[model samples]
Target: MKQVLSLWIGWRFYMARQSNRFISFISFASTAGIALGVAVLIIALSAMNGFERELEQRLLGVVPHGELTGVNEPIHQWQNIAQDASLIDGIVAAAPFVRISGLIQKPGGFQGLSVVGIQPDLEAKVSSIAQFMPKQSWQALAQGDKNNIVLGKGLADSLGLAIGDTLSLYTPSMGATKAQRIGAAKSHRFIVAGIFEIGGEMDLGTAYVPMDYAADILGLGDGVSGVRIKVDDVFAAPRLIRDLGYSQQQYMYLSDWTRTQGHLYQDIQLVRAVMYLVLALVIAVACFNIVSTLVMAVRDKQSEIAILLTMGMAKATVMGIFVVQGALNGILGCLIGGALGVLVALNLSSIASSIEQMLSVQLLSADVYFIDFLPSQLVLQDVALVISLALCMSLLSTIYPAWKASRVHPAMALAGR
Candidate 1:
């Protein structure tokens, strides 16, 4: 009955009009502050989560986990090397690749590209490039009947080339003399067989051709540039590549996607860590407002507290009333903020895309980043954690003020009144 009385009185006090307008205003400001802090924190964390997801799916999927390239000479025994590496545990599959640094000739002039030579069936075992393009486009490289090339969507857009378009390729000269090499780079022609879109910056620089054509153009017969490998764990790829390289006869350069794309992952984590710290401090500052609100309430209601104490109400019950009053503010703020945060997080990507379209702006540039546009992924766990933390902080803030209210002396308070 005493607990019920405390709860009833506390709720009445919370809902009742305060004589001091400033106290009511301060209490309202505290709720707003907590709500703002929580909503921003949830949105920021969700964006970071979305970026991590894209890193794994969009970028890492197309990039081989590990690679082993020849240092002094082209890999002549790539098939044997691939078979040996595949036999090892933790290794999923391996494919031979030929990398060519060249420029595609367009009407606008020459555009640079890092061309990859691949066998479609073998390439499928190591990377997911086939999934993003048509089956016919992916199979064109296997035909090996003509000089056909697959271009990235970004490259195609810039060069104004499409499928069936004949584009000229220029590579570094393999001439015997320096003057001959300086005079002109080697030039070749290819028909654009397909264009694959991954919506990444790599689209600007990456291209593909038949493995035979890649070696033939460079005048390296029956030799490949390197071996690409898929592994059980991407993080464990560097070590796996190194171990595989050690078993090879010639000097090899071992590398992984982490070397090329790890910066995106690290940047996401760094931003998330910094935002988490800043938002935590922001919530703490907002909680301080709750302290101030309760302190003023305790001072304002001292006379009422004294009357309650004198009326045979326990000091503990007096404390409970103030605690309940202050907790109501926190509960309301958390509920409002949590709901808003979840709603926004659920459709953040679409919302951002809409805003971008409306403003004629791009949040993430496709030419500079792996995936363009803002992304958001809300985890229920994150929302739960944020709400729980805010509530606990709010509950703690009520302690001192509640204790002060309980410590009110009936004689002293009545004397003041």
Candidate 2:
């Protein structure tokens, strides 16, 4: 206990008085570097996390948590299938649907789009599309109005469509004489009943129509393409789908939102890892200064070390003193950096927006990116990992210097001084 106390006192004196101006300046620079590196890393990673969350929400808004579809035949008696599936413990809502690839043409232009045919009343119970529509109620589409259609905002923009604008759709239908592509290659008018925006790829490529109209166009007689299922917990979808007896061999396939958007999530994780490694190099450079500063301090304090050795101080105790001094610098730097990192991460969004406005350049573009706003989600685990890594590096920085200081012999240090 006395030895530890003495070592603490020695560290305090070295930091407070014996340290020269240049060493003091280097210490300040190292601390500032660690703080800046940590702060920037936290802010960047939090923003990436935010964007990832936004993508997930938007993706789930359009993609059903899971879908059970027939492979060999159009789903007959789908309402029964839906009813049976909904009775499963984790199932929230299940609705039959028909999906078709079609072309939408206006007088101004033409665009290709995926058309979803749904029972509008049940759609809101299963998906967020109803909630995201800007005009016309989901009930409007449910009324079985053959002429009505709902367009996604990006699809509307691409084809120059608006609410109440007349658009034409071209689709293939089975014929009595032969399997033939039917429906008007020319314009068959449809009224754009609503517009929706969810900031996802779906918004750029999809539209919704009533099931009856889709059946008429596609010649599907009371048959649906699939049943979309919403679950109480999205993460449990795969197991739930399997438990519900949906499989490839039954001429049925199941798809989940996670499968549909997993690529984006993986890409985000890869980019985050690469960015962190690049920024960590900054902290590594800062830690190099800790090594140099401690080495010079050891050289300058040789006379003091010799006197302590002559006074019967163990070599281990001498090593511990400088180790404690070096560790104090690291701990102080980490504390300051960790605190600053948290503050910056919490406010990164507003700060980034302000900077973008001041510069008159958009950093996040809605047209090119899934989301427009900067997002920050500071995870406790990420912060803890960063702090741990920085602390380890700081301790490692003291190793060689502390070892060299311990090697100083009483005779040589005394003779040299």
Candidate 3:
């Protein structure tokens, strides 16, 4: 206990002294190095996390969580299927749908589009489209009297159509002729009922029409392309899709939103990993500064170390003193950096916008990027890791230096002094 107390006092005195300007400068540099490393890591990780969250929201907002389709036979009994699907634990809504690939043409232009036929009332419960309409109404499109159609905003802009404009649609279908091509051409006219902007490719390429109209246009005889299912938990969709597939063997093809967007999500994950590794190199270089600072401290204090050794301090206790000192520096740096990182993350959007304005260039333009603001999500686990790693590096920096200090001889150190 006395030995420990003596060593603690010795360490406190060493740090408290204001006599060694060079030593103080080196110590300050070591602390700053750790802090900078931690701060950059936090910022990079938070940005990555925010980007991932943004993608998830946009993708889920526009795509169904799961879809069920006929494998070998038509899903003729959609009502029964929807009812059974609704009974499944996680399902929130199940709406039958028919999809057709066609072209929308205005007076002077045309664009390819995917047309979805839906029961408007049920679709409201299944998807976010009902909430994303910019003009007109989802229910209005379902009214048979109106021959209404809802076009994605980008599709409307591309074809030069607006609300109330008549747009012609052409879909391929089989003709009555015996030697006709696999499908004959079918044409229909629809009045634009609404425009929706979901801020994704769906906004640029999808259109919605009444189920009956789509069925007739696609030449589907009382058959739907699939049923879109909304689930309370998106993460559970893949498991549910697998179970649904097993339950209806040889009857359906089941898919989840993750499957539709899996590749994109995987790419994001890979990029995040590469980014972390690249930033960790910054921390590694900072740790090298820590090692150098401690080594220099050991050399400069050789005479003092020899005096302590001759007095009574054991080699292990000598090592502990330096280790504790290094750890203190690391702890101080981590606390400051963590607080700064969180503050920056919380205000990242405002900060980024200010920078953009100052530079006269938009950093996150909505036209070029999916989102218009810088995003940051500070994870607690990342913070903890940064602290732990910094402390570990600081402790490691003491090992060689402390060993060299313990080896100091009274005769040589006193002679040099």
Error of 2 at 82 (Å): 1.9
Pick the lDDT winner: 1
Q: Rank the candidates by lDDT, best first.
A: 1, 2, 3
lDDT tens digits by residue: candidate 1, 246-359: 998899998998898888888999999999889878877887888898889888888899899999999899989988988888888888888888889989999998999999
Which residue runs does candidate 2 get wrong by more than 4 Å? 1-22, 87-90, 105-109, 134-136, 157-161, 173-188, 232-236, 242-250, 276-282, 312-317, 355-369
RMSD of 2: 3.7
Give per-model TM-scores.
0.94, 0.82, 0.81
Model 3 quality (TM-score): 0.81
Name the weakest run of 10 consecutive residues (lDDT summed) in model 3.
174-183
- Which segments of candidate 1 are over 4 A away from where they belong? 1-3, 17-19, 106-109, 175-180
Higher TM-score: candidate 1 or 2? Answer: 1
lDDT of each: 0.87, 0.76, 0.75
Candidate 3's C-alpha runs over 4 A off are 1-29, 71-74, 87-90, 105-110, 134-136, 153-168, 173-187, 219-222, 232-236, 246-252, 353-374
1-417, model 3: which lDDT tens digit per residue? 855764585468457634667767777777887788788778878888887787767667558888998876557778777777766888788888988787766557666788888887888777777877853568776774456789878677767788889988776654446445325657778888888876546667688888877777666778888888888888898987676656653478889988877766787789778877876676666666666766777777787778888888788777776766666677777888788877787778789989998999877655555555677888989888877877787777767876777777878898995
In terms of lDDT, which candidate is stronger, 1 or 2? 1
Full candidate order by TM-score, most accurate first: 1, 2, 3
